[model samples]
Target chain A: MTQRDHQQKKMQIRDGFIAGSPIVMGYLPIALAYGVLAQQSGMSLMELTGMSLLVFAGAAQFMGANMIAFSASAIEIIVATFVLNFRHFVMSLSFVNQLKRIALPWKFSLTLGLTDETFSVSSIYRKQANQAYGQYFYGTLILVAYLSWVFGSLLGGLLGDVIPPQLSQSMGVALYAMFIGLLIPSVKKQHKIILISVTAMIVNYLLQPMIGEGWGIVAGTLVGGVAGIFVLDEEENT
Target chain B: MIWMIIIGMAVVTLIPRIIPAFIVDFVDFPNWVNKWLEAIPYAALGALIFPGIITVVPEQPLIGIVAGIVAIMCAWFRLHIMVVVLSAIATVFVLTL
Candidate 1:
């Protein structure tokens, strides 16, 4: 590659790392909690970290650990995981659609790192910055976030007993805090989002008793998306 | 047996995430479909935050709520995400103490 091309690539990687740093901070506490919970559930350090490495999903892994603790069958846990992660289908579709010009290979590998945090950060970064960042940027962002998760899980699994219980419990709020931070900008841009988001939250809340949290999220997002189609203006930029 | 369950969970999770990338290349979504897709993040964020936030501190749900409100306030000012998160954590720590 030319000198300018190489320099630009370096910049993209640096920018991506910067963009991903907050997600790293957010994931550490949550992943640590996951490790502690998984370890408590009788998962070996290898098994817990293996799940983080392979699965790379926060909510599903937590649920999987919980089910294991309860002695839920393999079939039940797998099915529950599929149902919980079904939201990723929409997220991956949106991500692919956004970076349509990028190569298929990049899209394939990048989607593997697509979690709730990464997807929200990327989408908001795209809309707010109005820049179609390079695949290198996304690649680096995903890499850092993924590493932090795995490392945090390893630490939490090993030190599950060392950390104070109350402190770890308080750390549970970190992810939700990050979510709120991501959501506020969009809500400010479009008042319609407030309605859509509230609708989703209420729907999830009401349905959690019957359909469960996993399905509740899926149903909530679908209903809220449909609400968006009507509530959001056609001329409005998403 | 545990390994089997873990592997099974991995496969099921990977399928949903990876399949959509390949499919998006073949299909061209209509405009309305695109709009719906655009809204997914916000909706999903909403669902992910609620109920989960309230239940974060299982023993004292109020601590979670107070921390959540602190997060919303920090975010409203457009503070950095880390600041928002840290502030919320601090709120929880203080409340629990």
Candidate 2:
């Protein structure tokens, strides 16, 4: 590329990193908690880093750690995590639409870093911009998020003993609060979001202990998403 | 043994995220399909958070509730996400003391 093109590309990558800063900030406390939890559950530092590196998924990694503590079978752990992360499939599809022009190798690498937060940040950026961002934009965004997650886990694993128990326990609340922060704004825009959300919450709560933890979420999302389609169409027509 | 489980989980999780991007064409999604896709984030976050609040601070459910409320207020006012998260964590910490 020309000098001007290279300059512009660097600028986009910087913007991507800046846009992803909040998510990295958000991931730190939560991932720290994950590290502490994984350590407390008897994961070695190497084991902890390996899981964070390979899995790179927060909820599933937490769940997998819990199952490991119970000495649950390997297949069970694999299947359970797979089910918990099924939402990524939907996210990838949505992202593919906006990122259609990205090269295949770059798209594959970026997809590996896709999380709920990264997807949200990238998609919001895509919608606001007239054109798709270059590969560097996504690369930097994912790079920051990935570093926070892995490093947070590593720190938690190594220093978990030094932190006081009450403080560590308090850290668990940070993630759920972050989720609320992400959810409420969107809910305010469309009232139907509330309906879809509440319905899913109720379904998940009721079904979790019976059918299996992961399936409850799956069932709830399907019901809520289907319900939202009808509600959104009605609102649009009115 | 642990390595095997870790690798297994990675492979399974990789499929859902990677396969669709590789094979699926972006154009020509029906409107209803887009609507359905749009709804996933709301419903997914809701389901994950609501039930988690009670359980996350099980010994002190009230702290979790307060933190969640504080988070919603911060988000509603359009505060930075980091501020919202830190404030909520502070609420829980102070409450537990």
Candidate 3:
């Protein structure tokens, strides 16, 4: 890279770090609570920390811990987790174009860190950062968030009562609340999006008994995602 | 007892992470497929956030959920990320109290 290229790359990295800080701030408390909740639900420190680093999605880990606490079989937990995380595969596909220039390690590592928050920050900066530097910046974001989550779990496991019950219950809403922060920018004039989402919610509520957790998320996410995607494309065409 | 189970889960969880890293150095997904994946993240966020805003809150779960949805809508339209969060928390607190 030339001097200008190098300077530009540095700027992109800085942007990623800056934009991602807000999300990291949002994530720390929730990750901490997830850790504590995992232990409370009978998960050992190792399991909770592993999910923080490996699985990395708070929602799935929360559900997984619930399943494990109930003494669900490995197969059931695996299937449940697979269903809960099926959207991840879809996310992996998102990086295909942007990641084409990077080496395989970067691609693979980027995929590992592709959580909702990470994707939002990284994708916003990808054009400026390019594939290689975008992955590096995103990795930095992941490392920070992952450390917070791991340490949070450790703290919660060891320092249980230091955090009040009222606070912990309140922190439980943080993840969902973060979802609100994310959804705000997108609930634009796309009526199909609104319609598709409402339909999926109804479908999920109706299918709660028959399809169960794994199938419900899988079917609902696809139906909703595809319907919203296609419908918007048609609207833009006109 | 839970510690032992945690150890076991740690091992299981690492497989998914390590497998793709080791086996697939670079992925080559087709362009058309890529187009669809672009929509997945926003759609997924939408689905997750919607139910969260509408769910029954625990203390005063019923009213909190409704109030939260309204608070979020106002803050969102105003483009204030912080206000959205604070309002939701305040709504829950008010509904419960």
**DockQ, each predicted model:** 0.78, 0.67, 0.34
Q: lDDT per residue, candidate 2, B1-97, as tens digits?
A: 8889889999988888887677755456777877776676667777767677876668767778888889999989999877888888888889888
Off by over 4 Å in 1: A127-133, A235-238
* Cα lDDT tens digits for candidate 2, A59-125: 8999988888888999999988888888787777766655767777778888998887777666555
Give the least accurate 10-residue stretch of model 1 chain A, judged by summed lDDT: A124-133
Q: How far out, in Å, is residue B67 in model 2? A: 1.4
TM-score of each: 0.94, 0.86, 0.77
Classify candidate 3 by CAPRI docking class.
acceptable
Q: Against the true structure, whose DockQ is highest?
A: 1
Pitting candidate 2 against candidate 3, the one with the higher TM-score is 2
Every candidate's lDDT: 0.86, 0.78, 0.59
Clashing pairs in 1: none
Give the Å error, residue A216, model 3: 2.4
Runs in model 2 deviating more than 4 A are: A2-4, A36-43, A101-103, A123-135, A233-238
Top TM-score model: 1
Model 1 agreement with the true structure over A1-238: per-residue lDDT tens digits: 8888888778888988998998998888888989999999999999999999999989999999999999999999999999888888877887777777777898899898898888878777664223344888888888999999999999999988665878877787888998899999788877778888888899999998999888888888888887888787788553
For model 3, what is the alpha-carbon lDDT of residue B3? 44
Write model 3 residue lDDT over B1-97, tens digit each, in one string: 4444444444444344435444333555444344445555555555555444455365455654665576558646775555555556556555555
